[model samples]
Target: MTILFHDTISDSHFPSTSHPEHPSRVQTAWKHLDGLGLTNACKKGIASPASLEQIARVHTDGTIKRAQETCARGGGYLDADTPVEPRSLSAALWGAGTGIAAVDQVLTGNDRNAFCLIRPPGHHATRSQSMGFCLFNNIAVAAQHAIDHHELRRVLIVDWDVHHGNGTQDIFYGDDRVLFFSMHRHPFYPGSGLSSETGTGDGLGYTVNLPIDVQRTGDEILSQFKQRLDRSAQAFEPELVLISAGFDAHHRDPIGGLRIDEEHFRHFLDFVLDVGDEYAGGKVVSMLEGGYNVGVLAECVADHVQGLLQRSLKTGSLKD
Candidate 1:
């Protein structure tokens, strides 16, 4: 397993103690994993900040400049929910960079898979706007990297954050090379990802939205994921798999009302790994998105990383 992260994201600030998307979200998990020697056991490195040219793939130059100017002026809010400071811009760039590095690691055969520990959770920022506590769509940039840099025709993205990955779906909505699949809480924040919101143009039928209700059980959701993903993988025949891996659906999450727990997350990983094995030559990369309950989030991350290690061992690709 290869772990990519940035140490400087801690400088981003919301100035409100009530804000949920803080650096502690990943730090807690990193500390726990480190204490258990899990992090030390894996190959770890800091990712270089993505160049402006790389960011331009998913964001307009104006959007990039606006974010920089906002930070240059000592920071302010992009929307009612999202905030930015001097370090926030740097943090955002590194957030996207971690995902890019993860893809390179797996695709270059340096590792079977990789995980990105990032913050200011992305998947909400669009090509021209940054909102929903996200400055840029980290996963979208990484998916485009695989397509543009690696020339992969079919890439699979699985997002299980409690909220729909509206920005990601929007970016690839007209392109056929990428498949954006999301299982999120409907009638919730952002209020998108309806069953009818399929992709358009050359990308029709590539976007899969599973808007689960808060009433559904984790097992039920997991079962739906299995059936739907199996169907999609058969046709897409993805060469690479990317996960917009978010744990905010945990029952204890302040932002989400779902009842998912650690065990359920493990089950989700099982299905994701199976898909990678069957269609993607066992290559997968994951980017962190959302998870607020720090303790529960850390436990799930530990379990998730453990699963990655175990999977690599089983496939005889654990480079460490």
Candidate 2:
């Protein structure tokens, strides 16, 4: 497994103290990855900014222009929660590019699976707008890249963010090529992802939403995730797997109330890797979405990367 990141991800900052999504989050995760020796165990690469043409596959030209223009004009609030700085546009481009790069690395056999430690966390940005501190839909862009560039027919996207990935769901709601699955806290921020909100038209059964309760423990969430993936894998038979890996659901996070911890994240990774092995040639691309508490974010991310490394070694998929 290889880890893709860039210093600009942590260099992009919001001006307010109240914002929980800050650059320190990535810095903390990197610190723990180094402390735990995961960094040394895996390949490391710097991320490059995604081109406008690549981003245009999943986002509207107007939205792309708006984001860049907003940052150019001294930066302002795109929404109540999503603020932009001078460096935000560059950060978002790199963030989205990282996801594309991870996909390229895995599918090209450069790595078995890759984790993108990036920010200006996506999955919340819609085709026409940016919200919830997300500027562009990074996972969506990567999934599209896999299909267009790799000629993949089926892609599976699993979002475990505490909040629903409404933007991702909306982007692929009518496309059967991508199976979008999300498990999130109900009655929470962005207030979407109802179980009944399946896909429309050809994508009817492809969109799966498991709206978990706020008090549910990590075990409960894991069980639900496993069951859903097992059932979906039978029908979808994903050619590739993409994970919107968010650790904000951890018990210690102030923004979310779920009881997941570091150990649970490892277990989750193991399960996902097993699923990938079964259906997707063990190809997985995971992107960092949300994990606010800097204190524990690194631990969770390290556990995830360690799981990827262990799985690669076990399967003899590690690249030289």
**RMSD each, Å:** 1.6, 1.6
Evaluate residue 127 in candidate 2 and report its C-alpha lDDT on the 0 to 100 scale. Answer: 86
Judged by whole-model lDDT over C-alpha atoms, candidate 2 comes out at 0.86
Question: In candidate 2, what are the lDDT values of residues 121-156, reduced to their tens digit?
Answer: 899998888999999999999999999999998999
TM-score of each: 0.96, 0.96
Best by lDDT: 2
106-184: candidate 1 lDDT, tens digit per residue:
8886578777878877898888889899988899999999999999999999999999999998889988899999999
User: In model 1, which regions exceed 4 Å deviation?
Assistant: 4-15, 318-320
